[model samples]
Target: MSGGKAITCPACGGKIEVRAAGFTVNLACQNCGSLLDVSLPEVVLIRRYKNAKDRFALEIGKRGTVFGQEWEVVGALRRKDQITIWQEFLLFNPYLGYRWLLVADGEWQFGTPLADRPQGDRNRVFWRGENFSRLGRDQPTSTTAVAGEFYWRVKAGDTANATLFQSGETILSREVSDGEENWTQLVPVDETEIENAFGLNRRSLPRRKAAQGLMQFKAAPGMEQDDLGRMFLLAMAISLFAAIAMALLAGPSTKTSSMIQVPVGGQIAPVKIGTITVRRPWQFVTIDADANRFENRWVDLEYNLVDRSSEQSIDAFGLVEHYAGTSSDGAWTEGSHHGDTMFGHVPRGTYDVYVSGSAHGWPVDPAVTDAWGSTETINLTIEASTGAMSWGMWWTLVFALFAWPVSILWWRFRDK
Candidate 1:
């Protein structure tokens, strides 16, 4: 590899080569871990650290064709947020200027700095006619390690505020520092492509010791990483099929329906609707009551299911009300004219169903009359079903099935 200039490390008296001589401003000593500012004729030491030797996938002066352009790896940085650490490589070409290669979360991305700033607020931004929405919150990032050369002055412990916005597969990153604000567009690149370009052997690459230590702990039995995904997917498929079957076979199959007239002046007497036999061990019993087109009036319905063999009784209630009036905001209506009550897990038996209810006026429950000043009667339609399925139970089962896999995924993401 050839470079425009070379210098000696001020702290360790070791040789340092500057690949981008005139444009390169700062660099870290590969031998002594000392940060140096080489923008002037004389070399000035910025910082010194104990840890110097760090392994990188790509080394300085290594030239590769990335995205059809030959770029030389000029610098590398190891940065970290509160939770995870990642690596960044600065690639440069004399004709194309500079580009960035980022490796994090077992993924690789290529970044290009935008000459024109994006337009919009922090939450959303528009660049080149594409809208990008922000993901997560702004995070503080610290440069934990530095190597090779950079165009701008950089040192270990340099901090910046970073925010990421995404539009489809492309990501836009904004980093604000004390001196300047920079925007870079990042697009995901395949790991194989990166490996092929940089002549990297991924299998033999050194792993982060801290991450390896965390992976040493064994996972719970039956909850192995390989089986978790398969189990979750299988369970989801079963749940979906069960849902479709229930939608097709489950009966709210109406057993009986009747229209009963109730005088507004008095309480309604119990009327025997019919008997419904439940063959299943347990099922939901539903009662639907509707008072059609009745305004400013309500009907309260009570149901009684008396078991023939056990002589046991189960009671349920429902209400049907509707009110309409004109307000400052124009005509408005509230409350439904129809309502239903469901009794879940009813034991299998023959039950004689009885319906009784009362009707009254809204706001003021006085005796309503007809044109001749006679008591008015409101008609209500009551329906009964023995085969009502419990949707809540189905959803609860699905959630319980999905919980294990989702929890495991969350844990891995958080600790990664």
Candidate 2:
């Protein structure tokens, strides 16, 4: 009323007024329904806003592989709407070339057209499927200057596409224009049109009936009827096959050997058990005699030996001594050191044991003496000889055996 003249509805030819608060001119004619469009001045304001936000400001640099191809981010553009930030990035790739206005929002919406395709058609295809099929011909780049509430708060380097719409028509219907810019329109559909589009028929198709039909068609719990029985049978068969295969492939039950005797307070009984090679000055035995006598006896021992460090054998030489005592010294002792070799019979008492040995030999410098040396001091409890599947050893073997099957299954089902 104050500045712009009244606009007439294109469909009804009714005179419409431009309200101060709203940018669109709403026309309601008796012949035709309500029609709305932005006036020429409003179009100018919208262009100004879009232009202001397009000014290059910030620079972004990033590199990563997306969808198998390498993509590099060269620059970034942004537009503001109150607290919301609409961003677009300039991306480059060896395969895809340059792409501008890669639309992205806080809501995680992303769409882009092939670089070779027309920009206008690309934008149209993103929102509404490809238009060439429906329109029968390639639509020309939309040139109609749009208006309405399409203002974007501008910052330097922001190149976001501001959507402009008039009535129910999407004015910007293409991804790229002749001038190489993608735009979109945000047209609002009238209440009647929305209802019709959603297949709503007021008196004929009652809302209650429609809701009931929808509920009836909704997916039920459990599996789909089409293949439910077959899938369940297959699952049962698979479980049965797994059980049978495991039973067949499992090794024979390990035979438990009787515990061999280790004589206590005798010449160190020499026994070549496993890979350990011991030369006890008393009797040169790999077994600990004093530790075997009392269930929990701590024996002090000194040994100078060589450890075999091979791919198959990781030899560890130690006195498997245990003890139970309040004081370290007063518990027990038969300290006997005969010619550089020390041997002692100790009761349940904490006694120190030492082992000095070389594992492997110096590779780089052969002259380097005793380069590979390892020592492990452990405190153990000598329990009564109980015959059980050494849980630790059995678990280690189980883990090794199942590793291959577990890895294969993981690889097969990882994506699903």
Over 145-244, each residue of candidate 1 has an lDDT whose tens digit, in order, gives 7899999988778999898899999999999999689999999998888877887645434344353432433244335566667878888997998888
Return the TM-score for each candidate structure: 0.50, 0.19
Candidate 2 versus the native: TM-score? 0.19
Best by lDDT: 1
Task: For candidate 1, list the clashing residue pairs, or say none.
Answer: none
Segments of candidate 2 deviating more than 4 angstroms: 1-240, 257-416
lDDT comparing candidate 2 with the true structure: 0.31
For candidate 1, the TM-score is 0.50
Output candidate 1 Cα RMSD: 12.1
Question: Taking the tens digit of each residue's C-alpha lDDT, what string does model 2 give over 1-416?
Answer: 12324555454445543323243232212123222335444322112221212222212333444444544444344434222333444445544654433222212222343334323332233334433211111222211111111112222333322332222233332332234554433232333432332222233211122323212322222223333345445555655565565444332321111122322321232222222222222111122322223333333333422234322322234444333344655765332211122222111211122232221111221232354742222222211111112334345655554554445344323433
Task: For each of the candidates, give the backbone clash count.
Answer: 0, 15
RMSD (Cα, Å) for all candidates, in order, is 12.1, 23.5
